[model samples]
Target chain A: MIATTTENDSAEHPAVPTAEADRPAQSEARRRRLPFSPWHLLLAPIAVLFAFPFVQMIMVSFMPSRDINRLPPRFIPTTVTLDGYRGLLERSDVLIWLTNTVIVSTVAVGSNVVLCSLAGYGFARLRFRGRNVSFLAILGTIMIPIQLLMIPTYVMFARLHLLNSLAALIVPWLATAFGVFLMRQFFLSVPRELEEAGLLDGASRLRILWHIVLPLARPSLMTLAVFTLVGSWNDLIWPVIAISDSNLFTLQIGLANFQGVRRTEWSLLMAGNVVAVLPLLVGFLVAQKHFLATMSSTGLKG
Target chain B: MARSATVAVPEDASTATGAGRRTQRRSEQLAGMAFVAPAVIVIVGLGIFPAAWATLLALQKWNGFSEPRFVGADNFERMSRDTDLVAAAWHTLLYTGLFMPVSVVGGLLLAAALNRRIRFMGLYRTAIFVPYVASAAVTGLLANFVFNPEVGVVNNVFRVLGLPQQGWLEDPSQAMVVLVIMSLWGQLGFVTVIYLAALQDVDTACLEAAEVDGASASQRFRHITVPQVAPATAFVVIWQTIQCIQLFDLVYTTTRGGPIGATTTLVYYLWEQAFRQLSFGYGSAIAWVLFVVTMVMTLVLVAIQRRRGGEQPA
Candidate 1:
């Protein structure tokens, strides 16, 4: 049923945008007809409820310890203070953790973009022995749960003496199967004629990829980079298992340890959370449309 | 040079002959393999190779410091008699049972509500989706503060509303419930965004035509909109189930498998067994069972989607 629906939908209505696109004229017409839709009454309250945790997290991070521990848990702090942030900075290796995370994420994004695109283009355009088999093998690996891989992976890392260092984090995120699959899908949708034209002009395959294909693939590359950055930055379980050194800990591992040791220090924990989450939040807000578009499009196809 | 070879072979095939074509084909093949080599090495080295090693590890007795000794099916036999594993399995089932439907259905309802042209639609969408981007560790930390028994905001609200206060994460009976709530808070936005994308692609021409034929709004929606988004619904369901089965991060950050091990999902249980207790073989056995269960569940879901209406699982 799924197969049929996908085939028929694509064949029948090709013009329908897969990603969210603004239709200002239709929205303007609807706005003139009904100044307020009844849906807003329901959505507005639900939005507030959904957004409450984030608001609370930020507010609680600024509140003094006593205010946070108050009986009637004040929504608005009577007085804002820098004590929580100051304590987090003094008590934890949060700055070092932040730097480590940035390094890991930056390396991950760069590697995934380069490696996945090369493999994706190879699978999409070239005629080679075992291309389909190899691609399918890589895709099948995506379904293998990380739980299954960890025990033996840990053993392997132990044998190689790659444990308790950043390489343990960096190696696994170098090139993901999901990244390759996503890039291949994007490449397949691109017009073959574009590459053929380059071929006609005597461009090498690598030259064509760099000059013709990569420019057109900017959106998919950004999507891949965003996903890799977020995944590596937020990764906790693996880092917790692999790196026990406090100085080498990423932001997530540090925050988890911080929470365990200082359970009663609500302000400190909240401040750590805000610090860990702010960079991503800022990135998402700045590229809201691209972020939303990439997520929705990839979700539907994958 | 490969570039010169291409340049020498002009558009007219009559000028080049079979040798030129063969040379070009060989070069292309070489280029393809060169492009794919790095990815293959990483994926096989890290992903596939480790998986094969895990299968072997499941049959061995290892404690990290000693050499692994092959023990055949002893590890698998141990699983049959393990009570903690049974509890963890049941907890995983309970989590999947509750989380999969509620999030998917809630997403559909919310997507429908937000589908129409409205002011501040982008703002509403952003507010909902913000939680999905937050790390599970952070969400778990925030959940502890918000749901704390004594000084939590939820309890304070309960007191104001004249309701009895109750222990949340500290109470074994209520800890799983709290975990589920936190998970939904973080995941519902993802499901909603996918559904919203599907809803936008529903054929508006068909809906307008139905309206001209005097069909009621609810009738058109039930018959038309529901069928159109079936594939996305299937995708969301399967994806959410996989996520629920792999529940670890939130449990680690919030309960640490909890007050009485009440919230110990399978992954957390395996992690503790291997990492904490140094029973690598038994942990690998649990991991294998989990992998098989996930594969079966995915197959079953895909089969159901096929039978429903030939809707392809995205």
Candidate 2:
């Protein structure tokens, strides 16, 4: 493929004749460009297009429901009010859902970081038999979508009487295959001699892993923690199916109440949206660097 | 390194410390197993077992409240003629088809634009990524209001622009369009970030060469940049396609398979049948179909990607 493509390209372009014509003038023009090139100016409107929906959501949150649907729509709210947030706080089950989300995300993130890191180390560094096979099995699980397992998962939790409890929400998410994969890649990058030195010094494997590997793997751990946190925080389907009781609702399921079959309380719903999204927005802001780093590094792996 | 050297001394009874060192190696193995056992148990118990059980349940006639009885593929057989399932499947594919191209192209275009240094890059990235962090239910609720036929901002914008004020979600023909648009809104940001990361890694020297050779910006982007980000593009496409296929939350919240069930995705239908109507067996069958469709699509996509990637120069 490579040889044929290269040959075809040479045959088509015949570089010698036109090469000199292209070079000098374009080279001179490139050197005089502004630091803020016109191409850079193209970014802002594109950014605006990307940012439009979010700004619209916030704008709509401030408007009265009556104005939300008006033709010749208003972008800026003339009658900006705290009505959505107030209605969300007083009438909706938004508070309970928020609490449930916090609890579920905390547990899921904490467990994932600890378990996945240890398992990742064991898979990456330890020379245990069947390790490759075990890792492959875990990798295989990534291909199966959660939709396929919901029914049986629902039944299992129901039989265990874990339905409608935070346990069901946190359990399935506690250890992700992606986390293990990410952590393993991270562990593989750390020098083997660090753990070996600790082991040679008569440190138990747990102590060696804890004292040596964990500290070295902090960045990846942070990445995994953020992934787990975001994943648990935004999860909807499992909570929807597993917990019918409103008391058990995550912010997502709770907000689903504003959506009645006939008429939706648009103002309250948007307000509820603000409440639900605020924490995540703040969380993303605080961890934006780590989040971006994690995403880019994840791309490198898979 | 010193400690490893000691451990690697191949059963040498040097200084008569062999017994203790052997005991230590055994304990290390035990500890390793102990560390990994919990995660293994969790995956087996929670992940694999349930998935396997779901496959079995699909073959049986089971509603959660009853003693699930074996029905021997009756559920699978019935799924063949289930009109709602068929409609939902068609809608899901339509939704995937509509959503993937828009988000991918939007992502690629935005990423290309933003790859150059721009003022307030962080702020723009943050604003774009807000939808990704928000729960889909919330995004859906917002969309429902924004796309509402009578009062939606979309209609207002159209009217203001002297354009036709078409029904966004109420009209059956255009209902899927609203969902597709909303899906794009939710997905575009994530795909942009992914592409942005890929674009950052493209060789600047190669791009400079293209520029020096009198390639226009579009030509440079097409010939030099796109091929470099092909893998990330493939990843974004496959991931978005899978998510689109199982799209239930937004449709559930906004449309509820509305305006004549035009937006009922297969997962939504499965949720309705299994959880809503308690036809667990039938829903399970539908769920399997989704699994098959997703897996097959992903495989085909990955293969095309591999071939494309292999053709690219290092």
Candidate 3:
């Protein structure tokens, strides 16, 4: 292993070596007690403001449809019913829609993890002809507003009979430029010495990438997976345009149909909305650390 | 990482009698190509290929099922006369102009708050960040319920406070305002996170030095902290501007470019033309208009930055 684990050019966030856990006996318990501030009061309310929506959504979803549409809306549910969630799961195509969404997002996350990690390694650490040009070409596409490209992409997909299929939904997401960029940024932080040592020991390039670099890349891979999952799961516009078969609709498109089912049925729609947003909410909670790091490190496309 | 795999070829192997080095070099090249091939192919096919094709398709007249006929500059010419496209364009600019500043300044203020020595910081962070994770489509849907004229929480609060309940999402002028509020609420978390990170990296040593000079907390923040996060602020502005320009899903779910198209942004207009109207060529033209508008705005922002004494942080 290299003596220095940090890369010189990885300027985004320099790695700081953690201080020794066992301090000398004379200096034991030296950590200071921080002073208090009244900022907690200001912050608590804003936090409540941001988090109250999900609570409201959950509360309303359980209330009977009749209760939600009354003249004065009730903030507290007097009687919670499983009718909304039950009607959704049993009476509608919600199950199939959820299944399709999971399948699409899973495939998207898996492929993006594999492909973006590989391409990211290539761009970040390898030297090949046309490397700069290729990277630039990919990066330049980020600024091309999706609107400018959607019309022709739809036409092309239509011509190829890819419409109404899961392939259409999965194609554009298979390897995003953003994913590649994110991976590259992470890979750049990996010191080159580890690979050189592997090379000296007669490890092949792919073997080195797989055995050494990939293990070190788990954090970034997880971040990318979560991002891709959230994106593909929450996607709405493309699915609306590409998939016409109700059987193939992702959660967003399928959930949107709730609006049409009952124009102003707040309870049914809120239940569906909660169901649609639940996975991501859970996913974020599960991967909160990585999500925070990823957001801070990169500028995600909204 | 093994960049030498293809650097030493068979010829070098023969001359140097260095079998290990030669294999490694050749292997590196082949492996690099194999590693990147899948993603590059997809990017080229779905991304670069369509980008080029769109420019060509914009010059023709064809629906999804039909044969293309050359229309020369007809679509672009027609765009100049499209009132809906024009209105959408104006609304998009308004959205960007208003939303960009609020998201940036509000985020900076929130980040400044979060950066303090406060208790339950993680709880605050988690709660504040919840909205940002929800998809705009979901946000828009939930917001519709929250801002419903009769039963919405806003009206309910207005009633509790002994005030008039305004027509929120229903009225044309109020519709855009509600949409902007939704956009701000959802985006506030993201921008705050970015600013908080930048705030943490704001050279605490400099602030400590300023404290030695007897500067007040606000003064140190005004001088050291704000100036330190200037680069991040610039980035947030540009990034948020790009996002504002692509405002579609939320509008798609809530407004659908309605209330007489008051809330129609450029993207919504583009979708309507291509998908709803099946006017692919005209839609492509409108898309170009959006692309151009984004470019001009970005350029203007950059130019203003250049003129404002570009004092980049080290």
Evaluate candidate 1 by giving its C-alpha RMSD to the native, one decimal: 5.8
Candidate 1 lDDT by residue in tens digits, A1-302: 23343344433222122322223246446565556666678989989988998899899889987787776778888899888899999999999999999999998999889889988998998888889888878987888989999988898898899888889989899888888888888889989898887776667778888898889998888878888888999998889888988889999988988898999988888999999999988888776655665566557334
**Model 1 off-target regions past 4 Å?**
A1-35, A297-302, B1-18, B209-216, B311-314
Per-prediction DockQ scores? 0.41, 0.31, 0.37
Reference-based TM-score of each model: 0.90, 0.87, 0.89
Question: Candidate 2, residues A10-128: lDDT per residue as tens digits?
Answer: 33222100111112445547754776546446666766765676677788778887675555566787798988888777776778888999999998888888779877877876665
Off by over 4 Å in 3: A1-36, A300-302, B1-20, B212-214, B306-314
* Candidate 2 structure quality by residue, lDDT tens digits, B76-116: 88988888778887898888888888899888887666543
lDDT of 3 at B58: 83
TM-score of chain A, all candidates:
0.86, 0.82, 0.84
Better of 1 and 2 by lDDT: 1
Candidate 2, residue B219: lDDT: 89
- Rank all candidate structures by their DockQ, best first, as comma-separated numbers: 1, 3, 2
User: What is the per-residue lDDT of model 3 for residues A43-144, given as tens digits with 9 covering 90 to 100?
Assistant: 889988888788898998899866777767777887989877887776568888889998899889988998898889889877766678888888878778
lDDT score for residue A192 of model 2: 78
Clashes of each: 8, 2, 7
Which candidate's lDDT is highest?
A: 1
